[model samples]
Target: MQKKYQKISATSGIMTFDLELNSEISKVWDLIATTKGFAQWFPELSIGEPGVDGLILFDFGNGEYEEMTITVYEPQSILEYTWDKNMVRFELVGQDNKIKLRFTEEINEKTTHTPRDISGWHMCLEKIQGILEGKEVSFTEDEFLALFDEYQALMN
Candidate 1:
């Protein structure tokens, strides 16, 4: 299925994407909230704790790490965190053996890297969906550049 994304705001700097997956809430929760599952779709995540106020460290595999503090954590429902000057949130809604996964990224400022981040998140969501569907996924640099161009057009 083709993923759909919405630009929540251009001035306020927010983007949202919703995904429909044929999976249970618990399984979908683990894919976003656990270190192992994150490694499969997102970045290599290391957490100091497992709940609200916990620290999540995202390792980009280039010896660089970004530290984010968990702002809200509700099991199988919501997970919010601080990322740099912005915030990232995940909300999972389940109905009859399927899940509606919502991802929102709140950007604080528009920088040159804004398009890159937006494109990256777009690809990451696709990866997450693929993993849930028992498929292998990888995002290539060319694909990212294409997405970056698309986001640039959207933003401008």
Candidate 2:
């Protein structure tokens, strides 16, 4: 599950990851595009409207939330939204007997937090797979640190 990193510019970049899941495309779509499905995995996000320019709220607890806009929506195939200053997109493709989930993040600018954020996205995708496999998975700080190191190396 290694991510592909591309330095698009001195201050911007792109990261892409692909995962093959032995589940229906709809199931994978639900997890990444629906509120209830995200609650089971990435609970911080909730989809408000299921279309372009829709609102996606990021709950920060205690009645605090940040709003993200849905920039692209193509039902079960593509979902793209604003993530802070960057953009995050998810694409699902069904092939043969498996569903391919493609995630891409367009980094607007390079920051000290880039590596940490990249590592977090890596773990999040892994969690999604674990859910589909019905396996109990935990994301620990140690695991994130190790992944952070790996992605941080790419910055150099």
Q: How does residue 20 of candidate 1 score in lDDT?
A: 90
TM-score for each model: 0.88, 0.95
lDDT of 2: 0.89
Clashes of each: 0, 0
Instruction: Give candidate 2 misplaced runs (Cα > 4 Å).
Output: none
- Judge candidate 1 against the unseen true structure and give its global Cα lDDT, from 0 to 1: 0.81
Model 2 scores worst on lDDT over the 10 consecutive residues at: 1-10
In model 1, the worst 10-residue window by lDDT is 1-10
* Root-mean-square deviation per candidate: 2.4, 1.2
Please report the TM-score between candidate 1 and the true structure. Answer: 0.88
Which pairs of residues clash in candidate 1, taking residues 3 or more apart in a chain or in different chains?
Answer: none
**How many backbone collisions does model 1 have?**
0
CA-lDDT, candidates in order: 0.81, 0.89
TM-score of 2: 0.95
